[model samples]
Target: MSSPKVQLRLNGIRKSFPGKEAATQVLDGLTFDIHERDFVSIIGPSGCGKTTVFNIIAGLVDPDDGVMLYRGQEVESLRGRVGYMMQKDLLFPWRTVLDNVLLGLETKGIDPKRALDTAREYLSTFGLSGFENSYPKMLSGGMRQRVALIRTLVLDPDILLLDEPFSALDYQTRLYLEGILMEAVETFHKTVILVTHDIDEAVALSKRVVVLSQRPARVKAVHDIALNEHSPIAARSDPRFSGYFHTLCAELDIQTRKSA
Candidate 1:
């Protein structure tokens, strides 16, 4: 047996934004490695730099210090190598579900027929087959998110950077989407780095949960989730689930108290 390949690495990453009084430091010497086909979740306090880390990984923002490597080579940007889905679905109201999912491939100048076929396949896989012609406004929140996820997946990026993609939906819908997301990851064999505030979600979906400290954020802890089941719902029922949940809660609580 061999260890998984390292797909992405963040080495001593540090960033700061200008504030009214002074520079507000966000990430401070943060470091982590995302292995190929591994699902990793990042969690921290409210104002910690979780999203900033995603921004750096997605090449939307550059860290003030530190190096990022992709497959052992240092890279300045990962613009096309990573697919990002933010909290908002950000779907165009006018485009039909199919068109929305086709947006990424179309932008990349893919052949129309091929792109359409790919979009249709993903739409069907995500259970949006009959809703192809439906507009975003006509769909439920969960369905719209499913479409969003499919749109990202259709691009087939090496890594998926998900920033609270399921936060806005109802709990049941969130759970369902979690299952859908897991399926997508397995079906696509993608490496994922998810930024979430939900501990349970982190525990349920991740192979490892990386906890960050308060801003300027650093790695506080990283726990390898050893649940017997992979399904989010079923993982929760695993005997060790509660222990992991409580331990994560305690980690966050201690950080909160220190900051307070």
Candidate 2:
């Protein structure tokens, strides 16, 4: 009955990087809003500055122009309030699964006993219970990714910035992980902004999908995915899924052809 509250807002965000000839504009007047508990996926042609958007949101890089607001208050960057997970799991090989998950909390100086308990509870819930002592080298790709997700989630950030986190996994593993990610979002009440190249993945996981134009990227379109199911697999089975997927494909195709 009530409107969803805006958790994050990007207003006319612009960014450029120095190139040999001149500055290369990556994002130009990109703007969007993420609501609380919203799973929003961003898709665009390759090199469309999707990752640049994420970096700005994560405080890893600053934008050349525009403003970011959190909960109606203007802010420069969401460094402490956001959790970022990239395409690579980025797990330390020598550390055990539990240790890797505990890394963030340790860095924040959280009490060791409390942090261990929290990490173990998440591992158990995510079905990584028995692999606590297993090293990253000992785990499968999916398991390592699970550990990576746990590592990000344990920090308890208000928003999650996922930069194609499941892009490298097999289809089956990606589906399973999508389910886990959906569950985590619901359980933790997180707001998520995902940058992905996969249209199907975006349709299955996002409440809304934001499409961007090619380099010096700007918001091209935003589609609300109206699926009756939440789980990725079940979302695919929805009769509306094909329509959304094809529509998104067409948008990207048009962008690609124009760029070419």
Best by lDDT: 2
Residues 1-260 of candidate 2 have per-residue lDDT tens digits of 69888989999999999999999999999999999889999999999999999899989999999999999999999987788999999998989999999999999899999999999999998889989998999998998888999999999998999999999999999999999999999888988999998998999999999999999899999999989887999999999998898889889884423443
Count of clashes, each model: 0, 0
Candidate 1 regions exceeding 4 Å error are 254-260
Clashing pairs in 2: none
lDDT of 1: 0.91
Q: Write candidate 1's Cα lDDT for 1-260 as tens digits.
A: 79778989899999999999999999999999999888999999998989989898888898899999999999996988789998999999999999999999999999999999999998888788999999999999999999999999999999999999999999999999999899888888998999998999999889999999988999999999999787989999999998889889998984323443
